[model samples]
Target: MVSAVLLAAGQARRMGQPKQLLPLDGKPMVWQVASAACGADLLEVVAVTGAAGEDVGLALADLPLRIIHNENWSNGQASTIRLAVQSLDTRAKAVLFLLADQPLVNKALINNLVKAYRESGASLVVPRWQNQRGNPTLFDLSRWRTELLQLTGDQGARGILAAHPQCIHYVDLPGPEILLDVDTPEEYWQMQQLWQQYKVTKG
Candidate 1:
């Protein structure tokens, strides 16, 4: 079974507040992301929280997902990734990593990646937009579990990707949602503006 790990353990230092709790279309950023993950074709969804663990939990209280707190969140993203990966069920075949700040990643993108992974037999599945890779990358745990467990510091699977480029199967996708991430207050505001514009365009 494929499992998803939503990383929401960041301190959000640039935003001066927990970006996970910030409102996006009236829902907390993490909640929106988790909701999208829940809508995907996955066996389980796990949300990793840190500094704002309590509020993140509250925001996702209604969701049927597991919440895991990372005590080493200050050590950077790798720690949270390790925590999520280690906590995965033994039955899990592959795992998809999602970021809490990338609220635009919807169910379709995730399901598409899963479909590609199942059909291509690739150890790594990533989305590419205009030749640029994007987040919510899926890794076959049967191949990379040991390497992922040994990961340290903030690089967070980057070193693994660099070392195993041949294992990747990039899914060509449209739009910048694959790369759009909210890191600061200004970026969050910009995301809202862009979301509004997108809504108008879609309508």
Candidate 2:
């Protein structure tokens, strides 16, 4: 069975606050990401939190997910990833690595990745948009647990995936949403406007 790990332990030093708590479409940003994960056809979902763990926890209180606190979160994002990887239940054969900041990624995107994982048998599955890889990657547990624990720097899992490109499978998505990440106030504001436009079109 496949599982999911939502990474939300960053200090958000650039944004000056926890971006996970940043509001988007009437709820915390991380809540939207977590909600999407909950909608996936997976065996388990765990949200790894640090820094402002309690506040983020409250934001995701209603989601059906296991909240795992990363005490070594100050070390970096990789530390939180290690914590989550270690917390997986025995039933999880693989894990989808998700980022809390990518609120635009929906359940359909995650389900698409899961479907690809079950079909490809690749050691790592990463989403690609216009030929660029994106977040919410999936790693086959049997292949990368050792390398995952050894990850220490700020860059999350890219180095390992790069070193083993033969094992990495990419899912081609249609939009730039896969490349958009809310790191600055301007970007966040732009996303809000875009979301408003999308809503109007749907309405």
Report, for every candidate in turn, its global Cα lDDT versus the true structure: 0.90, 0.87
Record all residue pairs in model 1 with backbone atoms less than 3 Å apart, i.e. clashing.
none
Per-model TM-score, in order, reads: 0.96, 0.95
Off by over 4 Å in 2: 200-203
Task: Give me the overall lDDT of model 2.
Answer: 0.87
Worst 10 residues of 2 by lDDT: 194-203
Tens digits of lDDT, candidate 2, 13-50: 88888999999889998998899889889898899999
Q: Positional deviation of 157 in candidate 2, in angstroms?
A: 0.7
User: For model 2, what is the alpha-carbon lDDT of residue 40?
Assistant: 81
Clashing pairs in 2: none
Ten-residue stretch with the least lDDT total in model 1: 194-203
